[model samples]
Target: MSVDPEIHWPIPPKGGWTADDLDRLPNLPPHTELIDGSLVFLSPQTLFHSRAVSFFEWQLYHQAPEDLEVIREFTIDIDRRNRPEPDVIVVGETGCPDLNETRLPAASVLLAIEVVSEDSVERDREVKPAKYARAGIPHFWRVENDNGRAVIYVFEREPATGSYTSTGIFHDRLKVTRPFPIDLDLTQITAKRRVE
Candidate 1:
């Protein structure tokens, strides 16, 4: 199913959203960036997805280099037309300050990690990859919890026209160490959490 045109279409806002405009929004319901100009309701995270994100965050927090900074579900303004909040972002400590006011620049982000949920799998797997690539974000990781695995897609080279050209898929219980050096044990990361 196509996203509602009114919701997902990349239209130019009359005057664009400023930091003040973003702050004025009420905190009742959470919203997400959609193709820069529009905002859409963020779907609630499922138990499985939530657990996975927690696990990944814990691992990354302890294993990642001390100099690197990691943020969970933070928005980065890629351009005037695209703003996506990936599940996680790892960047150098210098680029992002300790304030929650501004949107991080895409160029400063070393990697963008997206944890897929049932409702957002298509967008995370397909739409976001191309978007991040076009924004020159360098690397994108897609974690599929339904199958209890993660697919690491590296955009080493940019495509001339469409999507990223140089892509690599790593499976079969491997360690991830490109964007940031970490010996991620996939099996441990995907271990089933006890159901409540």
Candidate 2:
């Protein structure tokens, strides 16, 4: 598969793409990410990925406190050369100022969640959590598809070490207290919803 030449793809500078370059890049594919000075173009999302993200987005929004906000498909500027977008982020109330904002600073993001797609398994499982932890994001969740079911791996950052420790792995339901008490039924992602 060849990239369309008409699309203006910017050449990386000497050190490779910076976090700010993402804003100026022309015709970059949606959800494009930068990792270790390299551009990562995401593959098309699968139905399972889409549904799981939506389910978590809705659940977090409803459960979050008045001072926190939930967002989906947004990037956090981790450093000069890395700005990977988590599938969902739970941010401080002031994290996003306006609807036009493209990204948030890592400090403002409280929790970053990634719903694993086949193409993003390694990154979601390993790379992203490390980046989020190093950036001082307090919490992280990795949602994996286990035989068509959602399995959430919850991690809390150890402030002393600046690393994430797995608090628990929740399959049928997710119950956590650190990041502002959240309880969700993992099975709801695959449950039927009534459309009015």
Candidate 3:
């Protein structure tokens, strides 16, 4: 896996950190997230993780429509104590692009992606999905780093249940028409990532 989150300290919110407290936090970690009213400080990402995220961000920007913007390590205010920072967020042209906005609404987010790390596998796969589904995000993409390569998983929300339905898994290339046509060659990207 490219990244592995060790949950530096699984500090619970026994009247601990609130969203307001989080906002007041002087030196928030580079990529801190609030999960189920608790604080989970993720471990630093590896070089491979940075390369993969950069690759995706670059590709999304190049291939996406003019209206779409690809952002990295962006945060969304989920609840009072549950703010999640997805690895990559694809949103429509938000007018306030200049500002370093603290949070983004769910409606503005078209797709949420999480590059699976060894320590965050369950959270990325099971926990985060439920939240994204409930937030009414149309699509979700999960990239599992396997020996420097990625196995892609795509899911679409089931409107009735506010859950997801797996579209398919891609091992070679990711070809999708929804959420604005995207055609990415995973093999080539991962190969280049390994060399870096």
Q: Model 2, clash count?
A: 0
> 1 or 2, which is superior by TM-score?
2
Query: In each prediction, how many residue pairs overlap at the backbone (N, C-alpha, C within less than 3 A)?
Result: 0, 0, 0
- lDDT (tens digit, per residue) of candidate 1 on 107-176: 7777788888777877787887877877777677777753656555455435456355545565545455
Which digits, one per residue and each the tens of the lDDT, describe model 3 over residues 39-71?
Answer: 777887776677677778888989989888888
TM-score of 1: 0.75
TM-score of 2: 0.94
Best by TM-score: 2
Between candidates 2 and 3, the one scoring higher on TM-score is: 2
Candidate 3 Cα outliers beyond 4 Å, as residue runs = 1-16, 95-98, 193-196
- Ten-residue region with minimum lDDT total, candidate 2: 4-13
